[model samples]
Target: MGTATGSSFDTETLRRGVEGTTGNTLLSLYADDAQIRIIDRNTQPSHPKVLRGRGEIAAMLDDVYSRDMTHKLDRCVVQGDHAAYCESCEYGDGTRVLAESMITLRDGKIAEQILIQAWDE
Candidate 1:
């Protein structure tokens, strides 16, 4: 786990946060004024789903945490104040999803994140 340049961003912590996805762990990795943009089949590039602020992000994470799925982080890289990772999830219903995220850090927390996902249909 590497630190992002002068930032205090801990790659290990971020990895755990992403793999866990529980509200507490995940929320701890984000800044209060963080924003998340999601792009996928459900949320196309033309009309992406955006979550502004920690509250909305926490709520969205809570919903995800409640789901019966297994998450695995495949790869992660961090440089300067930026980090990127790929994760795969398999749900109880045998559905699988692959997600890649690019994030920007501020004060050791995620300030902005863009995520793209593809799921089995």
Candidate 2:
């Protein structure tokens, strides 16, 4: 995590949030009006799954974080008011999921996020 002043996106905070999502404590890292877009094979580019606002985002993420799996943040980069990261997770059944996300920040919180993910079928 890099340190920078006068920027809403804090690398340390983002790192903590990603690591804490499994603990269900990452909601604090998002703004009340944050939005999230998910794109994958099921949810194609033509029909992406979109979550609006903190409440919706939180609900969706809560379900994800509650899953029985182990999460790892493989890579992360923060620049200006934007941040990006790649994460991988493995479930007990040997299924694995890989996700890459781009986040936009506002007022030190996550305002919007776009994620593309793939999973073992």
TM-score of each: 0.92, 0.87
Model 2 residue 78 CA deviation (Å) reads 0.7
Best by lDDT: 1
lDDT of 2 by residue, 1-121 (tens): 4322365555655556666646345778788989889999989988999999878987887888888787777888877778889988898899999999998877667788999999999
What total of clashing residue pairs does each candidate reach? 0, 0
The number of the candidate with the highest TM-score is: 1
Tens digits of lDDT, candidate 1, 3-112: 55466777776668767847677788888999999999989999999999989998998998899998888998887788899989999999999999999987678899
lDDT of each: 0.86, 0.79
